[model samples]
Target: MSETAREAILTRIRTGLAQPAPLPPRPDFTAPVHPPLAGDDEVLAFAQSFQGAGGEFYYCETRAQLAVQLATFRERQQLGRPFVWEPAMQEILRAAGVAFQADETEFLAHADWGLTSCEALVARTGSVLVSAASASGRRLSIYPDQHVVLARPSQVVAEIGDALRVMQQRYGTALPSMVSLTTGPSRTADIEKTLVLGAHGPRRISLFLLEDE
Candidate 1:
């Protein structure tokens, strides 16, 4: 308020601004934050972690076996023909003698199940990394009541970092607009602390592991 007081405050501020503050140390991005998974048991580890998160895991020794397992699962579950959009997945279904719906309008109206392929499977956290870059896009993995993921053993990674690196390398500089990691079926405990499944996404998620390697 006083002229002398203002002058003294300005001088103090000038003195404080004379020296630059020291910057914090940079982190090592090369080293992983968590311990990397060891050995050749990534599939086993993924299966364990995935099942622990309420996901169903089926290991198919071959594509033929995968077809049989898929057909059996469909019949056992009494589910209608699943909605599949990806051309690769459509071919696999057609070759396997499995009927699927590919119509977008029909899918939006009524679809009991949907089939998709993930970008990568994290062995440590049992999370499936999906992106809009794939043909499945966003809806197929979320809209259906039951979501089935077709994955190969080679796609399983040691950790989340490894999965992210795989995506980055695959896409290079042109990355996808949206990338998501789904751990399990959608669930929420927000309503009166009652856990309800399928609140935000598919109620059931099944992973069919095809042993191509």
Candidate 2:
């Protein structure tokens, strides 16, 4: 059929059937809002949820204690080498006398441990949200044998909804290309219903929750 004839017929058909339909005034989506509790309530919920999902959590101070904690983890796991975000964590590790790789790609390929910061912690699900546009990118969130996150108590929100709000506020319209909500080490029970962890991603996920200020 000729392009002009096809266009004319399609236009006539569309006009014949078209009607202005106003969407039913978007029903009031507002529901009973129960805001998340602050202080220990949210913290406890997050800890319980994260632990239940096979994630390990730890406490750490900024300088000395943080260094000691990392050292202990390395000795215990025998991590081949560490890969960390440059300005965010590499300097801190160096100041603590720990060695790390700078070339993220090469390091990620060989390193067993990968360290980065999180955007926020979802207390309801005990998950950490991260953006690839952040210093670590999505690779730091998933492409490693072990994932270590430095989380502050202030970053913990009552639920995933709150955490997402924080992200939206921070990035505005230009958001990261990738955002990951990780609850624990990867897992799967697809084969014969036998549960297996780290089937798709990191085998180990650890969060060092900094003491509340």
Candidate 3:
């Protein structure tokens, strides 16, 4: 084609492209549902359903109870499963033969456990959110084969929004690098119609609820 004709064709193409594409419809975001905290007993019951599906649970009232829990947890770890906890509980786990490491790299390779302080627990969803600023690195929860969390009943709330609000209030200026809301073990149904657990994260999750002595 001649230079003038080619130039004209290019200008037309540019103009057509500049006209802008039509926008798709917006998704609906409004819905009525109960908050996480609204149904405490029911949610706890639901969480319990996940038990024995390659998971465990413990309730404690004292340091001695903690010891017993650790004993059982240690047995699970010896069987090639991993666990997670809060740094505050490190000494107990250490006594139980579970190694403690601060760095995620070390923890992922050598340690079968991780420790993290949670921001809040949502009873409605049986979910807990771990802030990155907490002693337990975010990766600790997701990278292990099993997750063990320590949370007080008082820390459990009704909804996810309540947890977010607590985080905003507690950390007024600085927010955590990441906040993870984990309800159960890592799972996927992507493989040929079979539901598989622990695909991208922990295959099991256990919660230790400690009552004040």
Per-residue CA lDDT of candidate 2, range 1-213, in tens?
999999999998898779655668765568535554556677778888889888998877666787788788889998866777747677767777877776666763586878888889988788988888767777776878899987788898887788889989999998889888998899999999998988998999998886754
TM-score of 1: 0.82
Error of 2 at 26 (Å): 17
| Model 1 lDDT per residue over 1-213, tens place | 999999999998998899767778999988778775666799999999999999999998876888899989999999988888899889877877778887786777777899999999999989999888878888889889999999999999988889999988999989898899999999999989999999999999999998775
Q: State the local distance difference test value for candidate 3.
A: 0.67
| lDDT of model number 2 | 0.81
For each predicted model, how many residue pairs clash, with residues at least 3 apart or on different chains?
A: 0, 0, 11
Q: Model 3: runs farther than 4 Å from truth?
A: 1-32, 35-55, 77-87, 91-106
Please rank every candidate by TM-score, starting with the best.
1, 2, 3
Q: TM-score for all predictions?
A: 0.82, 0.78, 0.68
Task: Report lDDT (Cα) of residue 56, candidate 1.
Answer: 97
Give Cα-based local distance difference scores for all models.
Answer: 0.89, 0.81, 0.67
lDDT of 3 by residue, 9-106 (tens): 99999998999778998866775464333344743643454353444657777767766776677775674334344556666556545545544455
Q: Which candidate has the highest TM-score of all?
A: 1
Instruction: Please state the error at residue 36 of candidate 3 in Å.
Output: 9.6
- Winner on lDDT between 1 and 2 is 1
